[model samples]
Target: MIQPIFVYGQHILEQPCTDIQLESPQLQNLVNNLWDTMRNAQGCGLSAPQIGLPYNVFVIDSQNAFQAIGKGFRKRYFDAEDKGIQGIFINPQLLEVSSKMWKAEEGCLSLPSLIKGVSRPWQIKISYYNEQLEYRIQEFSGLTARMILHELDHTNGILLINHMGLLIKKYLYFKLKSIKKGRVKVSYPISTR
Candidate 1:
């Protein structure tokens, strides 16, 4: 089922999530719901908390994002090898990140109509359990890394807006306020309460 995404100002978006029980009967359903919800919203990634669930889980399918933007945009920002990744991440751990940093524009479904240029590591090493509950550690670079880091922040109760400078936050005050007050319009379903 495609769940409604919790918008900004919802306490669930800020509450840190707990590790998912691998043996739980609902694990697979939760994973499917996340993927469905993300795809329905046309998002590259989605975390459990974004849907009002408190589990350390997120789904990513950057291939959709790349295809949506077309080849030229992909060629400009990504390497030939960066085809993008598609998978579920459960109880993920950030093992390491490269010193190299890149700043790029990012948007979130929860914060509709808000986009910001955020700086994040170009490469990341992460360990996560896949949909089958198989544990694996892997390294990711470029756009994939950025997407993972963004979703990882969600599991940690950190929003992309948290990365903005004070001045930028001040500049976006009214817009943010409107979003928090459930006044923003978005293509997908969002729950402000």
Candidate 2:
């Protein structure tokens, strides 16, 4: 089922998520919901907190992101096809990230209609439990790494707005307020209350 994403001003999105019990019913449900909700909203990633669960879990399908961006990066980051096994990282740890960074405009399902330039490490090493509850350690670069990092931030109670520069933030102030006030429009379901 596609659950409504918690928007800005929602307490749940700001609260840090806790580690999920491996192979548990709650874990499975959250995984399913994250996948469904992310695909439904056309998002590259989704975290448990985005859908009201404060558990350490997030899903990433950077292939879609890569496809949208075009041919140049298709093979550089991930398999653009065979979409059956997307990254469903549970109890994920960002053990390493390169000092070299890439700045890109980032957005969130929660904060719809908002995108800001945020600099992130170009490469990363992470460990997590897969969909089958198997332990895995993987390294990623380019869009895949960026997607994972963005979702990981959600589990840590960090939003894209937090990474914006002063000028960008100042420019977005009233627009953000409009979102918080329910005056802005969003395609996906969001709970701002």
Candidate with top lDDT is 1
Off by over 4 Å in 2: 73-85
The digit string of per-residue lDDT tens for model 2 on 1-193 reads: 9898888878888888899888577888788889999989988899999899889999988656655755665554444452223688999999999998878778888898887777888888999988889999988787778888999999999998888788888988898888777776766777666
Q: Residues 1-193, candidate 1, lDDT per residue (tens digit)? A: 9998998899989888999899988899999999999989888999999999999999998776666677878875566887887989999999999999999999999888888888999889999998778999999888888999999999999998898899998999999899888888777888888
Worst 10 residues of 2 by lDDT: 76-85
Tell me model 1's lDDT, rounded to 2 decimals: 0.90
Clashing pairs in 1: none
The local distance difference test score of model 2 is 0.83
TM-score of each: 0.95, 0.90
**Backbone clash count, each prediction separately:** 0, 0
Per-candidate RMSD, Å: 1.3, 2.7
